[model samples]
Target: MVASLSGWLQLRHTSRQLHSRLAPFSTSHASPSPSSSSLPQSTPSPSQSQEKERGAFSKLLLFLPGAITFGLGTWQLFRRQEKIEMLDYRRQRLEMEPVTCTRNNMASSESLEFRRIVCEGDFDEKKSVFVGPRSRSISGVTENGYYVITPLIPRETAPDGVQTPVLVNRGWVPRGWRDKVVSGEEDLDKPSTSSVASNTGDEKTASWWNVWSKKPTSPKAKEIVVPPPVKVVGVIRGSEKPSMFVPPNDPDSGQWFFVDVPMIARACGLPENSIYAEEIEDEHTAGAKNPYPIPKDVNTLIRYSVMPQDHLNYTATWYTLSAAVTFMAVKRIKTKKVRL
Candidate 1:
């Protein structure tokens, strides 16, 4: 009994010592200290803070394109206003009495665009060209035709201060002259000229217009030829730059599309950088009765009357797109608290 009691007491002492050694480890893992839990969190450094600022700045840069577009829209608005003023000026200029052109006044031809002017000049019939496939309005309907642009050598100096010849856009003519189907109708409209003195020696050398009006029964359409020095009243117009869609004038083939003054001058062996005028109505007609082009259609208001003015609409479109993009970008930045 004494040995059993001693052995039991020794085992109990060993168990107590083992429990004492394990107590600290179990308590340490189960519950941390208040000091450790209450300590402040580490704050980001200045460099990290600066990086976040840079990220925001980069997000703002995303609006660069939209800002540029907005600027362009503003510019277009200014252009629109300028065009309106120009139209007003043209209206006033056209209403004024036709100015008698002098070399001094003609010297400033660029400023005289769309202004009515009276010029005395001789038509260089040899240099006359037909610019065609142009559309012409006849009796409220449009038809394909050609414009007769004849170079006029001014008895006076050209407005550009050069004796250089100017091109005169006389007017448009129907291709019916060349088409037999169209000319067939003109034949039916012919009046009996048998009793109208065909015996007159001057009848054989009749003007191209008088002969053309006589129909198929009359002589065939003659080559383009203009009469002598005459007084021309019309608008002084500057040549327009060639358009992307318009085919370039073929000088070699004698085909002209645009009134490219320099090209036409070179092709016609006239002075380069030529100044030109358009004829509104012919004062050289035999009487009040107009002949040559059966229907004389003079387009004095062709350019100024149809100027385009739509900048406001374009500005609104660009602004709307910019606003939408800006709103989306701002919302994204706010929601994500980050830069795109």
Candidate 2:
């Protein structure tokens, strides 16, 4: 019995020594936790980790273009409505009948812009100015020329016979100096003021005034005087000041870029506060027979009809782009989610 106990003790001591050596290794390399062990082990896929890492910044990058497109689409819709209303208003105003413009009704003349009006006047051709580099498209043929602007003195006055003269745009004439002067297939010479017959004492007096002002007559210095004082039909107009893109008027050199009424009035030595008008037509045909044809107001159809009404199309295009972008973003997001 003692030998058996001794053998058992020796065996336990050997087992303890082996256990101590293994315990050091076990402490250094600890076993897994019970909770981790209880769960199924899975190797994380790279794609799933990448999807989880995606932040709000990545989502914003995808949707920003779509948001901008949608905003532009909404803006186009508003512009479309404004354009439609503007076109309608202009069309209605143009179709209305001609009204008589008098000194009594002059207060409301500003509102009469683009409206047809009648007035009795005598043209002060001495103060006429040639506004040039003007081009017109007639029957698909382009005619490059200069516009004659004359001051009209109204016969009727405010109790005092003195009147405020209005500037009148007296139609287009071919460029006199640059090219061969041709009007409707006929070669015409430069307009001569000397040939203009003066019937009235006022005309004779004006001729004297012209001689005095010019001092020495220059061959190039030509003045055109309308023979009769008569009823004039025209449209009241605002100043057509040149846009920023247009070259500035060189009045001293007589190079005109636009129908700047104030500048023309100043250049012509007319009253500075003169209002302007565009004559409907002259009694005589302009060319060899008459150098000046009365200015025709702008054609209503040509002025307003060409306005673009493609806002609806533009809106649709923007919306379509927005929808396409949104669809692509959504599709990509779904693909990512599925991969994850």
Among the numbered candidates, top TM-score falls to 2
Listed in order, each prediction's TM-score against the native is: 0.59, 0.63
Worst 10 residues of 1 by lDDT: 188-197
- In the range 1-340, model 1's lDDT, one tens digit per residue, is 9999999999999999999999999999999799988977797889999999998798988787678778878987887788788777777877778766665556767777878877666676556677777786768999887777777666543342224466777776667642432334433111121323243334534556556564443343233333434566777777777669989889888778888877787877876756677777654543424343332334445434334456778888878878877787777678776543
Q: lDDT of candidate 1?
A: 0.67
Off by over 4 Å in 2: 1-9, 31-55, 95-97, 155-163, 176-226, 241-243, 281-294, 305-308, 324-340
- What local lDDT score does residue 180 receive in model 1, on the 0 to 100 scale? 32
